[model samples]
Target: MSEVDEYLRFFPYDEPYDNQGEAMDRIHTSLERGQDVLFEGACGTGKTLSALVPALEYARDAGKAVVITTDVHQQMRQFVQEARAITRQEPIRSVVFKGKASMCHIDVGYEECQVLRDNTRELVDARQEEAQLRERERQLLSDAQDGEERAVEARDAVVDELENVAERVQSISSEKNVCEYYKNNLTGNVDEFYEWLFDDVRTPDDVYDFAEARTMCGYELLKEGMEGVDLVVANYHHLLDPMIREQFFRWLGRDPDDVITVFDEAHNVEAAARDHATRTLTEQTLNQALDELEETDDPRTKRAANVLRPYRDALVEVYEDSFGFGERERVGDNWEDVAVANESGRDDLTIEFLQRYEGPGYKSDLEAAVMLGKDLDDQYEEAYKNGETTTRKDCQTLQSAAFVGAWMREGTDEGLHPVVSVRRDQGTDEVYGRAELYTCIPQEVTRELFEEVHATVLMSATLRPFDVTEDVLGLTNPVTMAYGLQFPPENRRTYAVSTPALFSSARDDPQVQEEVGTALHDAVRFTPGNTLVFTPNYAEAERYAQRLRQQGDATVYLDEAGVDANDLRERFTNDDDGVLLTSLWGTLAEGVSFDGDDATTVVVIGVPYPHLDDRAEAVQQAYGKAFDRPGKSDPGWTYAVEIPTVRKTRQALGRVIRSPEDIGVRVLLDERYTQQSRSDMGKYSVRGTFPPEERDEMIDLAPEKLKFAMMNFYQDNGRYDGPPPAP
Candidate 1:
C-alpha cells in the first residue's frame, strides 16, 4: 500500500503484529525526518527488529559500518541472530568491546588519580572520626563511677556483633570442596551487619547487600564497553548514576550519547533513580572523630579536624535536643550510642532549611545548597556561603557535605551501605566512615542523554500505555513507534484453571502446601508430555515444587542456590522431557522459552504482583499524593503489578506449543482473573474460546484433545503466523 509497507512485504519476517507495524512506521519516519527516536517497546514485541532492521538497511544505504552491542555476549548474539534474517539484504559485521579487566589484568590505574586522591581524603576523614571516638571513650571512662562493668558491657556488644557476623560468612562453594588447595573455610552463622561495618568486607554472601562489590565484579562490563557501536544495552546504572557513569565512560571515551539505549526488563527504573538519592552516616565516625580531637597533633590531622568541626556541631545539636545534652562517651561495653537532645546548634538545621527549601523546581535549590560547602574562587564567598573557608575546610566539611547532599551519600562503619570500601581493606578497621559507594542522579533526560545519537529504535512485546516507560525513563519527547508479533492464541489449547489452594502467607501450614501440590498434580496431568509449573513467588514455587517432587518422577526442581536463568534455560531446553518447576524470580518465568514436545502443559500458579519492595512502597505513597492524593488507588501499583503481570503472562504463554503440530495447554490458576470482567491480557485472555462456566473444561482439553480442536479451529481461523524464524 505504501513504499514502506511494500519494503516490509519483501522483509524476511513472515508476519508481524499490530504493535510491531506501528513501531516500524514511527521508526522509519523518525529516521527519514532526521529526528532522534526513543522507542520504548515492552519485552517480547520484537522491538529489537524495529531498531535493527533500520540499522542494517541504513548502513547499506549510507555505505557505512553498523555496530550493535547489548549487555552481554548472549544479548549481542541475540542481535546477530536477528541480523541473519536480513543478511541476504545487507552484509553485517560486528565486534565485542570488552574491558581490559575482562581478560585478567585490571587496566584501572590506582596511582595519582583525582578520584584516588578523593579516596585519600576519605582516610583523613576516617582518621578524624577515630580521634573523636577516642574522645568519647575518654569522656565515658571519666564519668563511669559505676566502674568497668558499664564500659565493658557497651564495648563487648560492638565487638561481639563483629565476631557473630564473621562466623556467619559462608564456606567455600561445593565446586571447591574437592580442591586440595581450598583456602579459608569458615562455617556457621554470625552477625552480618557487624562484618559489613566494623570489618567492612563484602563476601560472596554480600551479593545483594553491598553494591560496591557488584560494581567491581561487574568490571566484566567494561570488557564490552566502547564506541562506534550501533546499539548498546546496559543496566540503568551505566547512564544514570554519576560515579558509575564516570568510570563507565572511561572505557569508551567517545561520546557515550552517540548510541541508543534499550532497557530490558525496565520496570526497575524507579528503584535505580531512588538509589540515586539515599544518604547515610556511621556511628563509628562520630565516636572516632571525638577521639581524634583529643588524640591527634599533626597539621594534617588538625586540618581534618577543622573541617569536621561544624558537622560535629550539627550532630551535637540533634543529639542534645533528643537526649538532653549529656557529655559521656566511652566503651560502656561497646556498641554504646549516645546522642544528645540539646546542644549549641540543634536549631540550626531548621534555619538552614528555611534559608533553602524552594518549591516545585527544587533541583536548582539543591544546587544552591551544594554550593554552600564547596571551594569558591573567592574565599569570602565561602564564609558568606555557610561554612566555606580555606581549601582544607572546603575539602572536608563544606565540599564533602555538599557532595553528600547532591549525591545522597549514606555513611557507615565503612561508609556507604550495600557498598564496600576498596580503600579501607588495607588491614584492620583502620578508616571509620570511609565511603565505598558513590551514586548520583543523571541530569540528562533519556532524550537529552542521547541527543547526539543519529538514529535509534526500541521495541518489546509488553509495550502498553507506552507513554508510562517513555515519560519516566526520560524518553518522553521522541518519535514513538510500536511493532508487535501475531499474539492471538495459537492452535495451542489455553485454559485459565482455578486452584483450590489458598496461599498460606504462612509456610508452616502443611495442608495448604498439600492443596498446592494436588492442584499442580491435576494441572500437570492434562498434557501427555512434560509440563512447566510457574509460581508467582519464590517461596510458594519452591514449596509446591518440593511437594510435587515428593510424588514425582522426572521432575527437576533447581537447588536453592540461585542459578543464572540462561544456564537453567539450557538445562530446560536440553531436557525438555522433564517437568520444570520454576519460580517467578528464577529463569523459567521470563525471557527463556519451553515449547513443542518439550513442554506441552504450562501451569501458572498465581497472579504475579508486587508484594514487598521499599521503592514500590515509597512510589505508591508518593505517587498517590502526587496524583489523586489522600484517598485513591496507586499509580505505581498499576504499573508495577498490572503491567508486570501482563508481561509475565505473555512470557509464560509464549513458552508452549511453538508450532501448530506442537500443541500444549497454558493454564492460569489465579481466581483474580475470574473476578475481573476482563484482564489486561485483553484478547489474549482465555475467554475468547472457553465460556466462563466451562472454564474448567478448558483444562481437560489437554494437548491430545486440543490438537484436534485446534485443527478444526485452524480450518476456520487459519495460521495467524506462517512459520518460525529459521534456526
Candidate 2:
C-alpha cells in the first residue's frame, strides 16, 4: 500500500476519491523530502481534509509540529474540526490561534494587555515559590520524631493547606477579575495545561467558553498552549509577521527548521503579505494626530506636531492638485509630486541621507522632520509604559510618526515603492490625501520565509498556471500537483455569449455598458430559482443591479460596499427565488458554496481586469523587468493581468457546482473569451521568435442560441421540475 493508503485508514470515509488519494500522496512525498509543495485541488475534492489528515499524520510520526495558516478565520475553524475528527484515534493536539484583537477581552487594549502579561508572570512565579515553601515546611514537620503527635496534627493541617493552595490556583480568576482567562490557564504547569486544553477544546468558541467561565485570558492561554501543539491553526498574518513568528517558535520550544508550514487558499498569500508590509498615512489619520496633540500637555509632542505640520500640508497640496477635488480627471503630474515629497532630484528617490545620518551627508528639511518624528515616537512609547495613559490619539500619532520615519528610511530600497494620491467624495466634496510606501513585488517579503521554513505546502482551488504562480511567489523547483475537477463534466454547463460588441474594459462607455447589461439580462431571464450576477467591479455590479431593479421584474439583492457579504448571501439563499448581484472579487466568488437549487445560474458579466492606471502600469513594468525572458515576448502582462483575471473567474465559476449532485449553468457575457491571436514573428524580430499559444476558453453562442441552449439544459438536467421562472 502507498503512503496515502496507510493514512486513508484513519479518515472517516471508507475510501478516498481518486484525486484526494493522489493529492495526499504527492503532499506526503514532498513534505517528507523537505521540499516546498504547490498544490491545486479543485472544488469538491475535499482539499481541506486531504491536506490536513496527511500533514497531521506526518507531524505526529515525525515528532514535529505543523503550523497551518489560511486566509480567513472561518477556514481555520473548519480545518481544525476536520482535523479533530481525523485525529480522534491519535494523541495529536490542535488549537485555533486567533489574533489578540479578535480573542482578547474588551476591557484592555491589546498592547496594554501585553504589558500586563509581564506583571502576571511575576505574580505566578511568586505564588509558586510560596507554595513550594509551604511544602518544604510540611515535609520537615512530618520527619520530626520529638513531636510525633504534633507532627501528625501539623501534617494534616499542611495537607489541608495544600488542598486550599490548589483550589486557589484553580480559581484565582474569581478573586482577581482582571484577565481571569490568562491566570487560570497560564498559572499552572504549562505542559499539563497544553495537553488538557487540547483534549477538551475542539474549536475557538470552546476555548473562549473555557476561558470565560474561569475569567481568564483566552489569548494568553492559546499562546502558551501553542508551544507544543501538534497542529497550530491561525490566520496568515500570524505566520507572516516576523515578531509573531519569533514568539510562535519560542513558544513551540523549537527552531524554524523543525516545523512544517501549510498555507490554505494560498493564492491570497501575496496580497496578505503585501498588506502586512505596506504602510500608509492619510489626511484624516494625520488630522487625528493633530487633534490629539491639542489635548496633550507634553512639550515634545507639541514640537513634533509643529515639525510635521508643514510636511503634511505640502503633501496635501500636491494631492489636492492631482485629485482635482472631485473633478472628472486628474490635473497634476503624480511622478513630479512624489519627487517633490521625497525632496529628491530624481523621480525615483532614495533615503541615502537617512541611511548615513550619523555619517557625513547633507540633511534636508524632510530628513530632519523624519528624524524628529522617530525621536517623538520612541519618547512617547517610553512614557506610555511609565504609568502614563497612552490615549488612543497618542498611539495614533506615534504610529503615524513611526510609519513616516520607516518610509523615509527605506523608501529607496528596490523592493519598496512610494505612492501619493487623493480621493474626493462627489457628494461631500471632502478630499483625503494619502501617502503610501508599498512593495510592488511580494517576493521581497516572502522569499526569506520560504527559505527559513523546513517545508511549506501551498494549496488552493484556483491556483492555475503553475509557472506564473511559481515565479510570482518566488517558489524554487517546488513539487507541483494540479488535480482536475472531481465533479462530473456534465455537472456544470459553461457558455460564452457571441455578441456583436465585445465585453472588455471599453465597457466603461455608456453604449457598451447598455449592451452588456442587456446581454446579461437575457442570459439570466430564463434561469430558474436563484441566480448570481457577477460584475468586474463594484461600480459595474451596482450599475447592473440598478438596471435590473428598474426593469421591476425580479427581486434583486445587491452586495453593496457597506453590506456584509455573508449576510447578503444568507438573505438571497433564504429567498425562494431572487438575484444576487456581486463583484467578481467578492467573498461570494470563491469560499461561498451553493447546494442543489439555490444559486443555480451564475452570469459573469465581463472578464475581470484591472484598470490600466499609473499603478497598474508600474506593476506590469516591474514584473516585466523581473520575470520576462531575454529572448521571448514579455510575460509581464500575463502575470499581472490575464492570470489573476482567469483565477478570479474560475473561483466565481466554482461557487455554483459545490457537489457532484449539484448542477448549475455558467454564462460568460464577454466575446473576448472566444478570441485568439498569433504572436507576430516580425514584431519579435529584435528577440528570438516563438510559436503562438492558445488563449482563454471559448464557450460562445449568440444571445438567442445561448437562451435556447440554457433552457434545454435546465429542462433536461436541473433538479427542479418546472420551467425557469419568468422575468
- Which numbered prediction scores highest in lDDT against the true structure? 2
Prediction 2 global C-alpha lDDT: 0.68
List lDDT for all candidates, in order.
0.44, 0.68
Residue-level lDDT tens digits of model 1 in 1-727? 6635644632557766566666666666666655555455433466677665555455445443333433334454465456545544433333333332332222333221223233333333444445555565555556555576677666555455544433322211111111111110111122342233223212222322332332232222222223333323344555545565556555444444333344444344434554654444443453454354445343334443443444444444433343334322311232222322112332233232334433543334334433432433134333322223222221223344453343332222111222211112234533222221322222123444455445444444444455555544455366654432233344455554444324436345675455556556655543455778777667776777666677665556453455776666666657644667666555565555565566767777766554644334434443433344344345555544455565566567656755546655666665434424146445323333222322433443322233344334433444324531121
Candidate 1 CA-lDDT value:
0.44
Per-residue lDDT tens digits for candidate 2, residues 1-727, read 7677677655756778888887888788777888998888777788876777677768777878888889866677678767777666555677777777767765666556754564455447657855885876667576755566767666776677767766655554233223345566666445644555767436667767766766777667777667667888878887887777888788887788888889998988878877787778877777777776676566555455654554466566655545445452543322222322232332222233233233223224335434555555565545444435433113556656666666666666655667776665556666566777767788766777888887888888777677777887888999988775677777667786744333454766887767777777766666767888888888888888888888766689998877988888888898766889988887788766777777888887766776666655656767887886865366767777767777787778767877888777888776555432113323212111111111222355766677677777777775555656443
Task: Please give each candidate's TM-score.
Answer: 0.55, 0.81
